[model samples]
Target chain A: MKNIIIASTSTIHGSGYLDYILEELNTFFKEAETILFIPYARPGGISHDEYTNIVKTAFTKINKTVKGIHEFENPVEAIANAEAIFTGGGNTFVLTDMLHRNHLIEAIQNVVKNGTPYLGTSAGSNICGLTIRTTNDMPIVYPPSFNALALVPFNINPHYLDPDTNSKHMGETRETRIKEFHGFNPQPVVGLREGSWLRVSGDSIVLKGHLTARIFEKGKSPCEVEPETELNTLK
Target chain B: MKNIIIASTSTIHGSGYLDYILEELNTFFKEAETILFIPYARPGGISHDEYTNIVKTAFTKINKTVKGIHEFENPVEAIANAEAIFTGGGNTFVLTDMLHRNHLIEAIQNVVKNGTPYLGTSAGSNICGLTIRTTNDMPIVYPPSFNALALVPFNINPHYLDPDTNSKHMGETRETRIKEFHGFNPQPVVGLREGSWLRVSGDSIVLKGHLTARIFEKGKSPCEVEPETELNTLK
Candidate 1:
């Protein structure tokens, strides 16, 4: 019985950190008293303590204590014993590197698989997918592998933006990048725009949020799915 | 004596392939009879032969013959013996991976260092830097390492874009991304806008084209570099 929230971004425009998703998070982790934050992504080059403090302030609204994994003497043990978990947004490559190097992937996967409520946003959400090949972040660092949590069956493209047809930019559009990914990889990818997320409840992985998420499957035309759509039924 | 032309892109808005830079290439390779093309960074998923054919057509405008390295029985020999070389734009990760996997990084570097009249656009141009860490392309594949040619002193951000001050997008801007890169890395980065290029002749590397390039160094404010500025003097 996995309960997870994979969001496209942490702070939406005109909103404070976690303010947009706090209500859902409160309900998601109501039974839990503490959350172990995985601040390895280090968004904007912030330190682990600084990133965790940001989460701490947000969790105060939900009456939950927040602690960073870096605080523990044994991070793996801390993850395994945490009442809940969260991986924040930053550089996915660096986050993956730290996760793999610390040998915490399997431990966190085991905990989350065993009913630990998990939350991830942006680079964090990218890891819930089978692989991180669909992320839009720059490759600032090299991780051992592209392999991720496989918490979801497919991949994800966070901060997914549509191609500005009128713009003269020669760079590949987000859709084109995902399409190029499909050329070498057969796995499906969901282009989740900001404020959109996948709410995983047991076997049902539903597309939540107000905006439509674009789905791209191998050799198939990409299509948009409405909010509240159950993605498990998608090919 | 390294002779290299690292261009931001192969095609700019409303232009034919390599048309903007063809004159420079003609003068650059005036004495060369045949040019060895590296189509490993196949743009938009084009096949090696197909991409090479495009280069062939363009080279015809300058009365020079073009041959893809893929067509050779020995790729290493083709690089070592080439009169002129060109690595086209596509994916930098794939290009770096292929260069490393085939053990061609050193080979290509050796020839370029010995002065073989090199031309690189986009992904190709990115490799001329210290590492491929600043490329704007998607991480469709994981290269074994982020290291690049190091032919130049600093890293290059090809197709470098300025942040749209009025955009509502929440995703980190290109400037923000580069700043984050500096947080983790100390290497200097040059944001080469489309049509901007670095001309390396002997020990002096000069920024060419009309547009100003953005330079990002660790702990220093980013500054715009004028056309024809000497980048070799940068920190």
Candidate 2:
């Protein structure tokens, strides 16, 4: 049986994503001996020591062997050869660049297509879209081209949050931007907020999140719903 | 010579679209006697009296005779037989829907391709893209599909603005939302703030806005620049 977990982070590596970690492990590795971890999505300068160490700590607690991706020059072989894999998210642009540079996007796509169990977070989860045009991050860098692992239809905007009071900046609102998106689009868009994930088991999809998500489509008013909603029905 | 003037509005009958009114008058007694006006793109509704008055005012002001588009039912023929066409902007979603319903998008594309002078504004500007994925209105309504005129590579997020107030709201910033666009795409995007436009004459595209516009690309940092900068090098 193949299983995958895609998420925004390992909950800062044992902080916010503990439930996600436990669930992924228990669900995909009950009979497996090890979990191959990919961590290339984090920006080079960002602090991930705490996050990485947390993963090690979790594996140590569970008595499971965890392979750090940076240690392998050939990350593709490591991922393809593993019985199962876990993908953690940080910066989607960075992560996607690493995946593209290594030509691992296709390899992973093949792995999932071949029924390999996969778990992803944040940037990892975003790789499954048909196109990443819907992401909510800045294009601070450039890659070979705008290609990504086609796992879903629309782009995933992780770390999604409503504006806070402590900042002083000027820009268009997310709602307005999304409405702008509808003006040029005749398709439906899924705005997934934080603490939310889509779990896919074979042909089934389950949405797990703490808050309601906003849905936008062409020529129609926007709609909101709780986590139990089925997104595929909107099509 | 092929000259295009894309404006925000036109009189269904008269004093708007100064150039269009003047042109219609010349054609009335000469060889050109018809004008193709696309009004479906403005389903928010236009006052017939005001529409007619605008056109009448323009014609009278310029001492030209002209005719309105309401006399024709077949939009395809109306557009196909036109000496010139003017697209008015209101709600881009509604406009896109009507264009799609009448199967006039492809025809409009051909008209522009054929060197016909095409004029538009606001929502009218939204159609010149690979997809309408960048508009700045609500997707409260559904159109045929997310298809657009595709005259350009990326969607045009029209009527854009940088929050004027120092206060912050609980929404995604337009910059952040645009960055999200980069996460999923390597395609170049330009945020056209209001009163700004990309004017293409012959093989040259000139930015007509006095303010700096934001440029986004995947895997790269975002940059803001004045209209005269080296921004139009994008393919």
Candidate 3:
């Protein structure tokens, strides 16, 4: 039953984008009454009415009732009229190019496979996964490719850092570019640092974080998992 | 058991030391007679007698015979008096900081597990991986951490480019820093593009290359594998 959390930020919004977090996103909408915000991913430089008035001041401090996505030209009927569906965070290839030019990434993957209640932060938890390709930033900017939201298979490198002792910024870090992407492809990465997050529910997949997340797999030996644990698809 | 050939380049005998691909490395040592040139990794400004006379002009164009680790004061007896050790590509953190300050990365992994004959071009095939952390320039420069030449378990991002559709370079494009290094680690990458190479001989592994090698993996679906195939590794 699709309960999805997918964070990297809900309040520790970091480097501004309307600094979010709001008590772990109001504990996933406390009880929920109306929380549909989608901010059409800050398109045209910035104006979804200032990112839906910062998601209407975090759903008016948990009172709920927020609606954006430009009052719906039919974002799958405003994400099927919604009971939850949050999705904030900026610039994951500019919100996956406005969720693939408003096709709403397969209608938000069919309203989270009909279970609803999906919430995302930080480039909206990077479109659920399978191919945002890992994302730390600087593809220069393209947006409109749309193949993620598969729920999770690979690609997430969010805000991860630790090789810097002083910061000269030359190139390569983010764990040596995911260890040079395991030298081309073996498929199994996690790196998720920075306060971390990944809930899911129902099918169960926790992994919160304190560090020691590093997985990397190709031939194996880069292991370390131990946050909330539940991930398993690197076969 | 260890018939390695990791190469990328070696022809500076005159003093130039930095950028050398030199005719795909003199057609990869023409017929290989006795190629043993280590040149301790240049970059901090050459002079190991101009980096072993640029490995004696790429082993005198196949006439072979280039010995340098300061003519072996014991690099495990010059990598066990090689029949073929080669290792050429610059700045992989200054060739892993002179093979970990001359301890020689476990004496070149015990001279490739005593099969000897190993050769690694281009940052010496990224020290045969387990942790060069996948090189693509810029650990900025520190070296001597050791633990590569695992023959393959993950880590080797040699040269691999692909972002200049027009070119400006603000950053973030080796496929978005390797899909943000798969969101911080799910593990599985291999973008190896640029004349490519991976030829181990004992347990047998091959993947030469022209194009068509991009695999990602975490939740799955970034396919494309052509070269020589046979690169499994999931454990």
Candidate 4:
């Protein structure tokens, strides 16, 4: 059985870092005394220690200690030994590149699958899917491959926004981009709005937040699924 | 001498395809009788013929014929003998993939460098940079490399948008994304607003439009440059 909380974002608008989800996290990480943090995403080019400190501050509110994976001699060994793991948000390309370069993809996947509590937000949640093709982050760095942990059955488009009718911008909308992704990819994609997350326990996956998620299938029109909807059949 | 028009977008808000820039294009491509269109980007998953037809309809207004490179038996040879080339906007990954797959990168670069008129919009314009790392498009497909045409000295972030002060969305702003790009890439990047373009003639590259373009160089604050400002010295 696997235990995970895959969120669309770490900090929602007008909220402190992970403040909105602290209550849920308190329960999600109840079994663990310390969390192994992976800060490789390095948002705004912040150093690993700086990012880890941010995570540590947030986890402290719930009485859980946090340590960055970089602190360990071997990241693979750290993941195997961790009681719980939390990966924060940043540039998906950089996160994926680091994950591949460190060869931590399988180590993390294996432990998470074996029931080590896990939490991922934004770029972190992106790697929990089948591939990083749906990530909104720029290609700041090239990873060895687009393959991800495949902890979930389909791909995830985090920080997903609906089309703004009043906007004058001509760039492709989030819906249009996912439609374009389907042109080259056949896997289903879940458009996860901010404050929303998927709670995975064993083989059951359910939408946990108040907002509805937009589900996109290859040949069908995108439709909104209500909160608490089971998503394990999304593939 | 190279004569190229690299635009941020082919269609701006509330406008028909290429309507805003057709007048300028008439003079820019005056000597070319037919324009070779590269429809590899395939916006909305439209077929090559359909995408080419869209371009053909727009070019016909300027009294120019348009033929897709896919129409030719050999895409590389098609670029070699073309009087002019036009690569329209779509997905950058797909566009770069096809360009590399058909071995047209060097062919197009050679012809453009020798004064054959060339035009690129959005994804097309993205390829004129040294790499596709700055593109805002989703990575629907993996290309062989992020390396691009290198026709220009710096990368281009087409459809550049400023931070929305009113929006509650917490995703990284366009400026933040570019700033993150600089953390790894040393090259300067031009944030081209819609309706703005770069006019490259020989060794001189000038910004051409009514609005100012944002220039982002590594290790310095981003600044706005006036239209008609020379950009060739940005390396």
For each prediction, how big is the interface RMSD? 1.0, 10.4, 14.9, 0.6
Where in model 2 is the C-alpha error above 4 Å?
A8-21, A47-51, A162-170, A182-187, A233-235, B1-235
Winner of 2 and 3 under TM-score: 2
Q: Which 10 consecutive residues of model 3 chain B have the lowest summed lDDT?
A: B10-19
Displacement of the residue B210 alpha carbon in candidate 1, Å: 0.4
Model 1 ranges with Cα > 4 A deviation:
none
**Deviation in Å, model 4, residue B105 alpha carbon:** 1.3
Ranking 1 against 4 by TM-score, winner: 4
**Candidate 1: what lDDT?**
0.91
In order, the Cα lDDT scores of the candidates are 0.91, 0.59, 0.61, 0.95
Q: What DockQ results do all the predictions give, each relative to the true complex?
A: 0.78, 0.06, 0.03, 0.90
Candidate 2 lDDT tens digits, B104-143: 8888878777766665666677777655555554333456
Report the number of the highest-lDDT candidate.
4
DockQ of 3: 0.03
User: Cα deviation in Å at residue A194, candidate 4?
Assistant: 0.5
Which stretches of model 3 miss by more than 4 angstroms? Answer: A1-197, A200-235, B1-33, B37-76, B79-85, B88-98, B101-120, B125-134, B137-171, B174-235
Model 1: what is its DockQ?
0.78
lDDT ranking of the models: 4, 1, 3, 2
